[model samples]
Target: MTTSLSAAELANLVTAVPGVRGIEPGIGSTLRAIGSRIRQQDPRQARFGVVVEAGSHRAVIEIGIDGSRPVKEIVRDVQETIIRALSEAGEHDDASETRQDSDSSGVGNRNTPQVTVRVQSLL
Candidate 1:
């Protein structure tokens, strides 16, 4: 069985990375936040800048960097951090109840979401 991943949880993890500034707010996220407020939901919980596509097991993350590290290094760290967190969440477990081997890039089995990190700005 596949476990559901929460974008808010993932956002928290990403933001905790040393060189990460915060999630970059895009138009979609902004609109979602507004809609969530209208619906009386916490916009912060509703509109974390991470987008998870569960069907395809993919996550697109936009973040701002502190500019204290190389962009490539920071981006790679974000991807690895996300993959690691998902793996620990049992998101990469196979149908046979076995853990799959993560590749060098930290991508696990089909159940694991492929993480894409985009740096939107330098803080």
Candidate 2:
């Protein structure tokens, strides 16, 4: 059976990766967090830099790196980690090289979620 990962869970996993400083909070995430707090909801439940677009089966992640390793290497690790996590979640593993840009990496067929990693800053 296939399972879906929440944005918060994905964020947690990304943050745990070595050399990952933290999620780079964007304006949307900040506003969502503030709104959640104002509405008496758990702020932690608010989406951070990781955004999972269910309709498109795409995961967009923005992160701040610790700069201990090469940026490209760190980005690749992040992409691979996310892909592994998604695969473990019962997502299909029809791997394909779908490069969206120089910094982003997307793998898998249409049955799997495409992961896009963006390095927002160096910490």
Candidate 3:
């Protein structure tokens, strides 16, 4: 039988993703709360926002960065990291989660049920 993830577990997963830099301690709690109200999207992180949508099995993610590194690179890194960490966590019990840019130019990623990262004037 498969097991679902708790909010804390989810946050742990997020922090583990590569290029994620750091996740707020409340990542799991915020997602859990926003997941109910936001319906399609939620946001997190301080400097760089990392957005995620997670269902029982699958999840989608996007990372927003201000400068320094290209947004495409950041998104790719987030996608790879999230996929790797979550897959390893559950042994690929869930379908392969898809990661893509939400907007053109591939700078921003999509907002999802699980998480959304907004860069409030990136540092």
Q: Quick one: best lDDT, which candidate?
A: 1
Least well predicted 10-residue stretch by lDDT in candidate 3: 106-115
RMSD of 1: 5.0
Compare candidates 1 and 3 on lDDT and give the better one.
1
Of the two candidates 1 and 2, the one with more favorable lDDT, higher being better, is 1
List pairs with backbone clashes in candidate 2.
none
lDDT of each: 0.72, 0.71, 0.41
Q: Model 2: residues >4 Å from true position, as ranges?
A: 1-3, 28-46, 91-108
Candidate 2 lDDT by residue in tens digits, 1-123: 123566678888888888999999777666766676689964434576866555566677889999999998888888878777876774342234454454544443554657788888996
TM-score of each: 0.68, 0.67, 0.39
lDDT of 3 by residue, 1-123 (tens): 023344344455555544455443245534555565556433331112233334333443323344566655655555555555554555454345643442434223122122233332333
Please provide, for model 1 over 24-111, each residue's C-alpha lDDT reduced to its tens digit, 9 standing for 90 to 100. 9776666766776689964334455776655576677889999999898999999989877776666344444654454534434466
Q: By TM-score, how accurate is candidate 2?
A: 0.67
Q: How are the candidates ranked when ordered by lDDT, highest leading?
A: 1, 2, 3
Winner by lDDT between candidate 3 and candidate 2: 2
Which candidate ranks first by TM-score, i.e. highest? 1
